[model samples]
Target: MSEFLTWLFATLFVLVVIAWYLTYTAARLDRLHVRLSGTLAALDARLVRRAEAALELANSGLLDGATALILAGAASESLESPAEHGEARETAETELSEALELALTEPVVTHVRDSGPLGQEQLAKLASACTRVQLARRFHNDAVTDVRRVRRKWTIRVFRLAGHTPMPHTIEFDDQMPATLGV
Candidate 1:
């Protein structure tokens, strides 16, 4: 009787411990997903702000007509891109980056800076927006990496601890600052 009781208690203890561990893991995973969602939202907001800044610069009477037209088109496309951080979004943002690179030659930037207070302010806003986008992307990607790492654990997969949470992917876009801005 004593031996049987000992075996029963031991089994119950092991089961309880397993249950606790699984619960902890699920809770941790849930927190990670929430963090990821927040980071993604932040990235989206930064992208929009960057696009708006570029659009404002394009229409600021700083650049030439053709340059402004090209920049405006790219910024509009970025602003209107689908909310998903998918390939289309990436392409639109990359196009905007390219357009910005072409439009903001060092001499042109210097010309804008010398134009007036508003020109300097517009360039500063654009520069700040661009920098924020880069930072937001990095922070978002780091969160994604954390979630992916946790999701890939053998226990998480085998036990389905993540439940129905969809996997998160890193947002990759051409967020590099223009050379003129970097300096």
Candidate 2:
């Protein structure tokens, strides 16, 4: 009888430990999902801010006609891209980055710097927004990677700890900023 009791107690302890582990993992996965959502939201905001800054710079009459047109078109495309069209949005953002790089050439930077306080301020704002976008993208991708790693664990799969949550995807785009901007 004592032997049976010992065996039963041991089984109960093992089950309790497994339950605790599963609960902890599920809670961690939930937190990671929350973090991923927040990071993605921040990334979206930064992208919008970048497009808005580019548009402002384009319309400020600070740049020449041709460059201004290119910048405006790219910025408008990026801003107008629908959330459902993920690939289109990525492509538009990449095009905008390229356009910004080409438009903010040496001569344009020199002119902006020489234009005094307001030009310098606008330039600074645009540069800051671009930098923020890059940082946010990196953070978002990192979070996606972390969540993917956790979700791929055998324990998570066996216990269905992640539930019905859709897998997270990394954001990929050419967010390279112009070196001339000093970002």
Candidate 3:
């Protein structure tokens, strides 16, 4: 009878430990999801800000006609693209980054520098916005990676700890800024 009681107690203890572990994992996964969501929102805001800055620069009449047209078109496309989720939005953002790089050539940088305070300020804002986008993207991707790693664990799979949560994916795009932007 004592042996049976010991065995029963051990089994109960093991069950409790497993339950605790699963609960902890589930809570951690929830926190990671929240972090990913917040980071994505921040990344989107930075992208929008960068697009807005590019549009402003294009409309300022400080740049050449061709450069201004290119910048405006790219900025408009990025702004018009659906903010939800997909490769289309990522492509649009990459195009905008490319446009910014092409439009902000050395000669244009020199022109902006020579144009005085307002032009310099606009350039600075654009540079800052681009840098923010880069950082935000990195942070978001890191969060995605962490969540993915944790979700892939055997324990999580065996216990179905993640529930029905859809797998998260990393956001990838060319966020590199123009050399002339000094970012």
Judging by lDDT against the true structure, name the best candidate. Answer: 3
Shift in Å, residue 100, candidate 2: 0.4
- What stretches of model 2 exceed 4 Å from their correct place? none
lDDT, candidates in the order shown: 0.93, 0.92, 0.94
Q: Give, for candidate 3, the lowest lDDT window spanning 10 residues.
A: 174-183
What are the per-residue Cα lDDT tens digits for candidate 1 across 1-183? 999999999999999999999999999999999999999999999999999999999999889999899999999999999999899999999999888899899988998999999989999999999999999999999999999999999999999988887899988878887899755
lDDT of 3 by residue, 23-107 (tens): 9999999999999999999999999999999999999889999999999999999999999758999999999999998999998
Runs in model 3 lying further than 4 Å from the true structure: none
CA lDDT, candidate 1, residue 4? 100
**Which candidate, 1 or 2, has the higher lDDT?**
1
Q: How should the candidates be ordered by lDDT, best one leading?
A: 3, 1, 2
| Cα lDDT for residue 108, candidate 1 | 85
